[model samples]
Target: MNKEARLSRLTRMALGRESSDYLSRDVDELTMVEELKNKYGLENVYRFDVGKNIDGFSPLIQDVLETPELLGLITGSLTEYPENSYQRLRRQLSLHHDIPPEWFVFGAGLESVIDHIARAVLDPGDHVLIPVPNFDVFQSVSFRMGASLTFMEMPGLCWDGNILESLCRKMKEKTYRLVWLSNPVNPTGQFIPQDDIHRLLSHASETRTLVVVDEAYGEYTDRPHAVRSASSLLKSYPNLMVLRTFSKVHCLPSARVGYMAASSERLRQATNTYRPMFPFSWFSLYMAQLAVLDGDYVNEIRRRNQERKKCFFNRIRQQDSGLETFMFLESDTNTLMFRHRDLGADALHGLLAERGFLTANLNRLTGIQNQGFLRMTLHGDAVNEKFLDACRWCGRHLFR
Candidate 1:
């Protein structure tokens, strides 16, 4: 086949493929809830199924509803209040992270931002490096843009500096345009050190490649400074783009608010080329603004989350002798990744779902081979206890 024909075939394959249904659950909604109620008890049944912070609920909703000034700022028209509000937000975020306001582009969400970045920077067949066991959104967007994804398997339970050097070598081998990674990576919850991040960026800069860092869970980390904030890195590396979201940290996933910090030139190019779709709803923008400004609520959620994660770690250590357990990669995040040799995670996940517990199936996540590892999001004391009991029960019944 000719080159054009091969390109056409690849595009067809991409466009024809369905969006991933990993988020889909087939259990009866009512039955699932009832089972949750039964296992964890009606009052204590906590859903750690997603990355949302339960503590941010009341303050987030309350702030959005009570503040009308926050509601009126839509994309098209900018009155003084709305303009000032946006400027204020930009100023605060820029000051907090020590980046220029011009370096950031506010978008509908991180997924939208990724799509925009892909559109701006990638051509068909261009190579994009990504660590495996990632959020599917990265691969999905890259494929849609006709970019070839090069997978770099993360060193299990730790960040290996060698991986970054190897990735640099891979970049040198091709006209690879981008490197995408998640700090405190999803599923594994491993934190990449600042030095390693610097080496990656240095390599990318030398090769004229853009490094896209997704700090979606940076706020949850105990040592936030160890991982270079994308905003801060932008000053030195113009080729670096930092992606952040209100979804995980602020519990505003429904609000669909996210932003990218990069060099001013790159930010302008992305905004111009992609033309971000505006105003998911006046309500979404309002909620996002409220969430960002509500420092007390953010602090409270962080505090409770830290406490919950500590409690979970303690419980897991105590129970790990009999059951398979995954530990956080020496980071201050609430997610844990572990492997079980005897019971395949798919079978175990199914069994847990039947018993009213839901967790991320690690095997299906990255399509990487694993011995039944699963990722669990820690919610709070009650939820942590339930997960512990569920795992203990599963270990005894399923593994035995």
Candidate 2:
């Protein structure tokens, strides 16, 4: 096929995959919607999207909305809307990172920011380096921008020095424009060490390539502020940008607020070229400000996430030896990636979904040929127990 024809085909596949919400099966679990309607004689099923609340936002959100001052700030800010609230949010985020306010652009979300970055920086046929087993949005962005994505596997189990050497080698062969990576990787939940991050930044500077570090899950880590220190690397390495969001940690996925930090000049160019509007609602901004500023809420969520992770992993280890379970490289985060001996991930996922449990099928995520590997997110004691019970049931019935 001609290059154009091939590109068109790839775009079609990417668009189809991106258009569908991958976690719909999980939504089917909220039996209370219809059950409550039938029991209470309500007119319609008042469905609560349970899957959306990975980070519980009940009493805290309610309290934030009740504050008149907070609401006033949101309304006042909206009156003379700055070029973009995204930019203002980016400035607030940079303050946390100790990065200058001028060093970033605000986008509706990390996905949009990445898409804009790809379009702004890469020409058709340009090569972009990315680590595999990443969020699927990276593939969509790369394909949409007409850039050829070059995949590099992360060092297994941990960050390896050789990965940097390999990246340096690739840089020498071609003048690649961008290198995109997640700090604490999605699905795997592994955090690359500070040394490795520095090495990657150095390599990027040497190659004159931009290194985009996606730190979406940074706040969920034990060191909720480690990513703040990461911004310091940009001082010496102009070719570095850090991406952060309120989605994962703040549990504000519906807010759609994410931003990037780079040199002030880069930020200016990005804002001028692709100015992101207030895609997020006023209520979202109010809630996000409340969430971010409340240190207690952030720390409590992190602590709970850590506790849940430990409980889940401990239970997994105690499972019968007949089930082949492989733990993720990084165990600190709330997500666990594992592989079993017999059951295929798809079948296992379906079985779990039927029982009101939802997990990420790694087989589909990494495109790795693993029959039994799946990723589960840890919520709390009650939720963790429910998940473990589901797994145990699956082990006895499916594996047997």
Candidate 3:
């Protein structure tokens, strides 16, 4: 009997949509470099191909990682569901956000949290609004729900009342079941302003739309001068759902830890339906618990990240010319997506590889259509200098 013939409609339907990219993946940097080199057949992929935040653990987190208690989590029994442990984690997160613990929902990462939220909110044939050129993981949420996704162009940092009125009119007409936004957007690395966010929340209130604000890169927005968190809106806007992750400044991408903040009732319901199959190990949870209250450490990271971003910008600019051509588009986040007129992202990726640096070609990403956008995860002065050197080399080759 043929396998296709043997399969039931239910089983076949369960496979849902297939991914265009991969059947398997690992988050390890070395493995990623190897995979990209093999698939693209490039040499010396010294830098990663995506926007990766620099991994820096403070002395507090470092000391905890070295202890026996942290070690115990890895060797411990996996079957025993640690409900109390998670409850404690939630409590700590709530205090950090200045909200009640019941408002939080933990997951493997923001990816799982967003997927579960989409499932919780959407039905078949529903509508979704997401900004263009976002993180690829968020699309999976809409994909699984069999929903229609509309990618909106971003209103830049100074979005005004006219745009807000136009947006509200659309929301009123379509009444989207869900509106997805990535604050300090991935790939672009700029923030949607607070006033603009408030207007969207107001619109969501009218439509009863589930507004998903993914703040995975939230910590990066906290500058040395001023700090802010969207979690502050939870009280007044019950429809607003926010996501935060350990992947960025927390330096726990492999740990796969993240959580969501919303009204207590919504999260309580979402917990039972969403399971983290690539679940957080006991080790990940334990480590998160240790650092949950380290607000000062998070601020220090923000200060350092700002310094690094400044260096990257300065190194790439035409200092004496002062015209600011070949600059990174405005960003408050750690990832920098710099634009070039002479080369498309795909061509630049190849040229950078030839010069022994690896950077992502943003041309192929679904919502991205325009060319010549090369993406890099901005790091400290030393690595930024190396990247600058490569850019200078590539420029000479490209022009001559």
The stretch of ten residues in a row with the least summed lDDT in candidate 2 is 44-53
Sort all candidates by TM-score, best to worst: 3, 1, 2
Give lDDT tens digits, candidate 3, residues 1-400. 7887786653455366544221125447577567768876766566545444565655587987788875566556476654434788887787678788878777887777877887787776788876667776666667667778776655542234665566677788896888777888777777778878887898889898878888888887865434466788888898888888887777777777888888758554765367654467766777687766566777887787778867666655646522233657767777777765676666667777766677766665655555567777776688677777777666666657
Instruction: Count the clashes in each prediction.
Output: 1, 0, 1
Order the candidate numbers by lDDT, best to worst.
Answer: 3, 1, 2
Task: Give the Cα-based TM-score of candidate 1 against the true structure.
Answer: 0.82
Cα lDDT tens digits, model 2, 379-400, are 6677666666666677677536
TM of each candidate vs. truth? 0.82, 0.81, 0.85
Q: How many backbone clashes does candidate 1 have?
A: 1
lDDT of 1 by residue, 1-400 (tens): 6665656655777768655424654557567677677765544434556666666554656754666664454434353233212565577677667777767687777888888888788878898988776777888778888888888776654458777777888988987888888887765677777778888888888899888888888777523333246566677998888888888868778877788887858455665467434535555655665666656665666677777777666766674444454333334566676555567878777656655667766666664555576666776687667676766677677535
Please report the TM-score between candidate 2 and the true structure: 0.81
Cα RMSD of predicted structure 1: 4.9
